[model samples]
Target: MEYYSVDASGYSVKPRGVALPRSVGDVADVVRWAAQNRTPVTARGAGTGLAGGALGDGIILDTSRMDRVRYLDGVVSAGPGARLGAVARLLSGYGRILGPNPSVGPYCSVGGMVATNASGSLSLGYGSIIDNLESVTLVDGRGDVVELPSNRHYSDIISGICRRAGPFPDTTKNSCGYRLDAVPSPDMSHRVVAASEGTLGVVVGARLRTHPAPRRRALAVMRYADARSAAADCPRILECGPVSLEVVGPGIMEGYGGSCVLFAEFHDSVPERGGPDHADRVCGDVRRAAGVRPVMIREGIDRWLAGRNAALSRSLGMTGDRAPSIIEDATVPLERLPDLFDVIRELGERTGSTPVYYGHAGSGNIHVRTPADSRVTEWYLCEVMALGGTITGEHGDGMGRTGFVRRQYGEQNHMLFGLLKDAFDPHHILNPGKILPA
Candidate 1:
């Protein structure tokens, strides 16, 4: 119980007990027991979530024992406890890979990734979990094992919710509240679980779409005077067909010898003879579009991406007194990125906190590291909402952001979310107090 108290988010709340279920039947049994006892059940994965999504004060259902992976046709079906790294290793032998790669790397679980709709730098090209998911199997609050897309009742209920739901943030990725907007129809209702944060059901297994690995890759590191300039040019750089575009703020650029740096990576899936040359040509086009020459260009595979993925950990190691802030995963439209930077600048001016920014710039999602003050966080989130941005992009609205879900989505949408929750978890025992009040 003590071990399940904290996660990468640094927030602690000791659970009453930790339940390790070895199979989907065991999971259903535990959920059933919890519901009958009127105790909350929180489904946990690798416990590497940056938000407080995996933490709860009631029963902590650890799914690590359910690690299983199988491939059929073009989709990979993985158990809730299966680690992303393990799945990737298995898929690599088949020359395929899952699209949404979270920075936590192999340590994060497939279930956690789906729960948060996780996305990495590659999301700029491949899309998020919600986009790649094919189907899902989960145990609802009633202790019933349900396979989505096959459950017509569940699908119709979600489709009704989607029809009545309001518009979501127009961003590349979003993980704020119930992703009702993702369910275009009853057939695609399984997408509603992508970022539901386990309030609706406990994920047992998921079938995800995989992509062919690129034959060649190239990375170009560009330096800019500030994040604003780099962000202002992202829309243009995006035109070069690069697979990923990431930015590092000054706080993390000390070792790179620059104020801000952007990493643009282009991939060649075709095994043509001129793959390297093609990458070079695209790199040159990217440089021309940005109107700046790259500081360094690495052809083929390299470790440059490892550094970018480690930016969050490095920034946290250096935050002496102020821990990593909760107002980190705000994402806006690509065209509104410069305005997002303006908000960060104004936040610094008003609070005297030097915010660190680094994340998927192409998707307009920038992770911020600043002092965690209630008033400052509120003001910053308000500004983000004003700019048509979501409070969280990849990290789900766990305990950390659940209180603000109603504010992010207005009363009508929030009510729709509650209705969806009721339809799935009639007893309200599955991860209570997550997307809605317990």
Candidate 2:
């Protein structure tokens, strides 16, 4: 119970108890028991979530025991508890890979990834979990096992919600509130659960789309005087057609001897037969788009990406007294990224707190680390919204940002989200006090 009280977010809430479910049936049983007792059931994976979505005051359904991976037809079907790293390794054997590889890939679980719509450096090319999800099997609030697409009744309901739901921020990736925009129709209704944060249903299993491994890859590391200049150039760099465009803030750039650095990686699919010349051409295009020469260029991947992948950990390590703010994952329109940096600069001056920024620049998503101040967080979030950005991008609206969901989406969409929650979990037994405010 004590161990179940906290996750990677550093937020803690002691759960009533933890149940290790080995199968979908076991999960259903635990959910049924929770429903009968009128207790909240928060579905948990490896507990690697940074938003504290897995912590609860009621039952904690640990899905780690349900880990299972299978290749069916053409897609990979994985139990919600399956470790992402293990699944990726398995797919590598078949010359395939999962798209949304978060930095916490080695420790995060498949279900957790789906819950947060987890996206990583590769997401610029492969998209997020919502884009790659084929189908989902979950236990709704009523303790009924429901599989999307197969359950037309629920699918129609989701489609109806989609119609009434408000528009989302015009960004590359979003994991805030219910992903109403992603569920365009009944066939794609499963997408709604990609970032629901377990308030809608407890995912038991999921089928994900896989892509063939890139046969050729190139990486270029570019340095800028500040994040704003690097952000200002993201749009042009994106036009050069790179698989991933990542940025490291000055805080994390200390090791690399730069104030701000952008990593642009291009991949060539096996069928394209791209070779050294292709990599050189892409690098040259990226260099021209950047309007400057690169600090380093490599033909292979991972060598330069190692630093970008460790940005979060490095930022955390550097923060001595200042804490990572709840308003970390703000993502604005690509064109407004420079403005976003300007706002951050103003915020730091106004609050007198040093801010660290990093994340998927191609998507206009920037992760900020600053002091824990409610007033500062609210001001920054309001500014982010004013810039047509989401309060959260890849990180879901868990306990940290649940209070701001209505502000992020407005009263109309917040009400619609409530209706959607009712449609799935009428009793509010699934991860109560999460995405929606009580």
Q: Give the whole-model CA lDDT for all candidates, comma-separated.
A: 0.87, 0.85
lDDT of 1 at 288: 86
Model 1, 1-438: lDDT tens per residue? 667999888689989999999999999999999989989999899898888899999999999999999987879999999999999999999999888988888999988999999998899778999999999999999999999988999999999989998878898899999998898899999999999888989999999999888777777788888888999889998887777899988857557655788998777763331364875687668768995787546543446778788788777765655654654799999999999999999888876767767999999999988776778788888898999999999998887778889999999999999899988898898888888988
10 residues in a row with least lDDT, candidate 2 = 318-327
Residue pairs that clash (backbone atoms under 3 angstroms), model 1? none
Instruction: Quote the positional error of residue 45 for candidate 2 in Å.
Output: 0.5
lDDT for model 2 comes to: 0.85
Please give the lDDT score at residue 185 for candidate 2. Answer: 85
* Sequence-dependent TM-score of model 1: 0.97
Clashes, model 2: 0
